[model samples]
Target: MMQELRSRKVEESSAREDVHTAASGDQVSTESGGRTDQLRTSGWAAEGPSRPWCRPPPCFSPSSDVEVWLNRLNDYFAANEVPQDKWVAVLKSFVSDEVYVVLAEEGPTATFNELAACLKKRYGSGESELMTWMRFARRRQCPTESLEEFADPFGLCNAAQTFQRFIDEILHGLNFAYAFIDDILIASKTPSEHDGHLRELLQRLTNYGVVINVDKCVFGAPQVEFLGFLICPEGIKPLPTKVQAVLDYPLPKTYQELRRFLAMLNFYRKFLPVLHERQQEGRPPSTTSRRSRHRSLRKV
Candidate 1:
């Protein structure tokens, strides 16, 4: 009887111990779970299964249309539920090297809208509505192209020929002045002479119903930028920006890249006489040399 009583007491103690262990386990599990939740809520936890990062769109190149890029970026923000405060940072991250350099000048405190405006002002086509309509009206169908091909609504055919004809008709018999498209350059020996030339040119243009953009017109400037050259009293030179671009160009790694680099250099070849020698050196190996190299490889 004593043995049975002792066994019953032992069994009850074991059951209580088991219940206590289970309760302690439950408490520990709850505390650990609470910590995990707290860490997540405080944003201290590493990105895991619960946390996800959205991939940004392609970076904006200098050639990209800023309005289109902004529209696409806004779509990305809406789809990803990105916060407004983060938009500036996101935009700064996606701009190309050239654009990023310009944006960096704006400093970190600039808002998204401010940055967007800066980009638009710098890169956006400043064509007026009337100019756009005139170009649209002046578009002609090419003889080789079909109606469907020629009817590209967005594309504007080069209106250079039409503009040239118009300029020639208006500025005929003007010896002191010449114009390429809309850019009219009036050369003279004296300020008084230049003034006369300018007046005559303006009167001719006015007679032809040519309304010039006063803001774009530079009057009596000692030096003017025309056709990527700085024309002054002394001599013409390549623009500093164009020279800087040549300096900034990366060394070509492939034949195609080399060709493109050489082509770019050719633009300033008139100013840089040494480029002629460099171009010769940079030219691809001759057909005979290539065949010789192939034969040598085969022999090896």
Candidate 2:
């Protein structure tokens, strides 16, 4: 009986040991799997992550606008988070073979900004400010031309300035009416006052030889839509349609899409109090942040 009891006790102890060993193995396996997942997600695994991609800008040509082309190229690089070291190579890939030869003749460029400056010097319009002002000052109506034809001067790169000056001249000393580019807003407390104001504005425009597009004109509106906002006697507010469009936007899956999403949010940020904070939460880490994280992982 004593021998049998001792044997039973030995068997129980062995069973407990076996269970403990199995549990320990499982714990080790789970820890290893967790570490592997961490490495993969952080892009430090054997395969690493795929390089970011974006659509290349249109090829630069002699006839292309150099400043616009350079702007687009810069946007593409920023969208893809491309390293500065690859800028010259990427620029070379997007040019024609002839343009490529020209760039080669200039020798290797040390930086993207230097290459851009070289392109601007070689291909830009190079119009001086004094020449532009002189052209503006010398503008005049031809004998056979209509008022519209006379007002629109050709080769004037600063059309916005021309429009602003024209509007300011026509609306000078008008207290009740204000003009923004082509849109005019006439404010009055009563219908009679509004009628007077409108007629006065129309007369002034007529005197300046400016013709209004009747289709685009709104007459004495109590509430009006202007520049994506609804203006009423109450206050200005974002259009419901615009708000709905924002709500309907799908989750961004690419860098370009993310940028567009952020831009949309920024436009209405005045209405959204916490929008800036929310945007920061989703923003990708900067290059500096990524490098710091990499250093930390190396230490680990």
Which candidate's lDDT is highest?
2
RMSD of each: 25.6, 31.6
lDDT of 1 at 74: 31
RMSD in angstroms, candidate 1? 25.6
Kindly list the per-residue Cα lDDT of model 1 for residues 107-156, writing each as its tens digit.
12222233234434543643233233332232221111111111112222
Assess every candidate by TM-score: 0.45, 0.47
In model 1, which range of ten residues has the least summed lDDT? 98-107
Query: C-alpha displacement of 144 in model 1, angstroms?
Result: 35
Error of 2 at 215 (Å): 1.6
Candidate 2 has its poorest 10 consecutive residues by lDDT at 97-106
C-alpha RMSD in Å of predicted model 2 compared with the true structure: 31.6
Evaluated against the true structure, the overall lDDT of model 1 is 0.45
